[model samples]
Target: MSRRYHRKSRQFMIGDTLTIPQDKPDIEFLLRMTAVPTIDKATGADKKVIFSGHVLVTIEYVACVPDGTQPIHFVSFEQPFTGAISHRSARPDRSIHLKGLMEVQELQLVGPRQVKTSLQLKVCSVKLVRCRSPLPTHAGEA
Candidate 1:
C-alpha cells in the first residue's frame, strides 16, 4: 500500500522499505514528525513484529549526538494493511539493526533522505528486506 507523511512542508512517501541514517547533530526526531508502529514491548513481547501484505515502511532519523558515547537515534515507521500480499513482510527497523557495518550502496539500496541536508551524515548504510509472511498465527496458538 502507498502512504504519505507531511512534516515541515515536506511530504515523504515510503513504500515497501525505506532506510535513513544520520551522522551529525541536526534534525532531532525522525524527520521532525512521522507515524510509527507502537511496539508494546511489555505485553506484546514481540521483538519480531511479523507483518504481511502491502507494507508501508518509513525510516526516520534524528541528528547524531556530537560525542560517540551515545548511539544515534533512529526510528522506523510501518503502516501495513490487508492487500495483495505481494511482499509479505517488511521491517524497516531491521535496517537500524544492521547499521554500523554496511552501506546502502553496498547493499544496493538507497535511503530517502534529503541529500542537501543529509550531507552532514556519514551514513554507513541502510537496508530493507522483503520476505514472505511468517506463520500466520500467534505464538503457542493453533
Candidate 2:
C-alpha cells in the first residue's frame, strides 16, 4: 500500500548569542552573514510529527584596529533546534519526510564581543507508506 498526503508547512524561530574569543579583536562592523539548516531526525507520535535539527551560522565582519586599515574576520557556530507539527494522519508506524527552508530574520551586535541572530525555519512534511511485494518461488511463475 502506498499513499501520499500534504500538510501545511510549519514555521519556527531560533535565536542564539555568540561570544568572540578573548584573543580575537572586537567586531567593528558586519560584512555578511549566512545560515544553513539541517534535519537530523524526524519522528511521528500520536497525531503529531516532531523534528530536531541544527543550523550552521557563519558571519564575516571587520575587526576593530588601532590603525585606520580595516581587517576582516570570520566566525562560525552551530545552533540546535526542535519543533513539532500536528497532522491528521500522523502515526508511529508511518514514515515521515521533511523539507526545510531557513532564513536569517534578524542579526544584531549586542556589544563589542557578542553577536545575536534570529533564524526562521519553514518545514513541510510528507507521509510515505512503503509496501513490500512477495517474490515468486519459480522464475516462470508470476
Candidate 3:
C-alpha cells in the first residue's frame, strides 16, 4: 500500500522603487536580502503573512588620498523591508505558511550621492492539512 497526502500552494509577487540615502557619492551598490517570517492575523480561514526582511546594501566609491591617488572605499548598510501577503486555506493549523524571495531588478545612479533602486519579490504560500483518505483497517480489528 502507498501513503498519500494533500498539499496546496500559491505564489504572489510585488515590486517597488526606492531611493538611496544621499550621504556620500557612490559608484555602485550591491544588494543582498533575507526573509523574516511573521504571521499578521488569523480570522475565519483567512490569514496574512507579513513579509519582512533586511537588505544588505554594499556601496563602492572612490576616495582621494594624500599621495595624489584615489582609493576605493566600501560601505554597507542594512535596510528593512515590510509587506503583506494575504492567503486563505481550509486548515490554518497544520503547516500553513508563506515563503518569500527577493531580487533587485534595477539600480541606477540618479544624482550625486543618490541612487534609485527597483526590487521584485515572490512569495510562495503553502498549506498542508490532514490526509484526504481514511487509513486501511487491519485484519480482525474494528
Candidate 4:
C-alpha cells in the first residue's frame, strides 16, 4: 500500500523560545540562527558578553488566555520551543545557541493513524542564554 502524508491539526507557536518537543509536528514553528556581536570586552574593561550559537526551535504548544493578563516573565514561558544545534569540534555535548526568525517549512505525518508528527522550523532568536534549557523553564525563554 502507498503511504500518504497528511499532517494532523497540531498546534505550533512562534516566540523567543522553542515550544514543541523534537517529536512533535507544529505549523509556523521555527528559529533562524545567526551570529552577532556584543560589548563584552571594551579595550580591557569587563562587559556583558553576548553568546551567539545555534538553537533548536520547535513549537510544542500554546496557552491562550481569555483576558490579557500576561506578565513579562510569563511571556517567554507561554510560547515554548526546543533548540537543535550542531557543534564545531571537540564539543561532544554542546551545540551553538540559535537566534533569529523561525521559519515554518511544512507539517509532516509519519503513519496513517498519526504515529508521529514533525514540523519544519528555522531558528531565529538571538542567543541570549546558553544552556541545555530544561523543559521546565525552557519554553520561549530565549
Best by TM-score: 2
- If ranked by lDDT, best first, what sequence of candidates would result? 2, 3, 4, 1
lDDT tens per residue, model 1, 1-142: 4221211111122233333545334443444323322211211112323222222233334454566444445544344332111112323333211111111110112333332211010111122333333222111100
TM-score of 4: 0.20
> Would you list the C-alpha lDDT of every candidate in the order shown?
0.26, 0.75, 0.42, 0.27
Residue 24 lDDT (model 1): 39
Instruction: Indicate whether candidate 2 or candidate 4 has the larger lDDT.
Output: 2
Instruction: Give the per-residue lDDT of model 3 (tens digit) for 1-142.
Output: 4231122222333333434455543444334323222333212244554444544445555643456556566655544555555545444343434444453334555554555544454444443344454333211100
Off by over 4 Å in 4: 1-77, 90-97, 105-120, 124-142
TM-score of each: 0.21, 0.78, 0.46, 0.20
How many steric clashes does model 4 contain?
Answer: 34
Which residue ranges in model 1 land beyond 4 Å of their true spot?
A: 1-71, 85-142
Candidate 3 segments whose C-alpha is farther than 4 A from its true place: 1-47, 63-68, 90-97, 126-142
Clashes of 2: 0
Candidate 2 ranges beyond 4 A from true positions = 1-6, 131-142
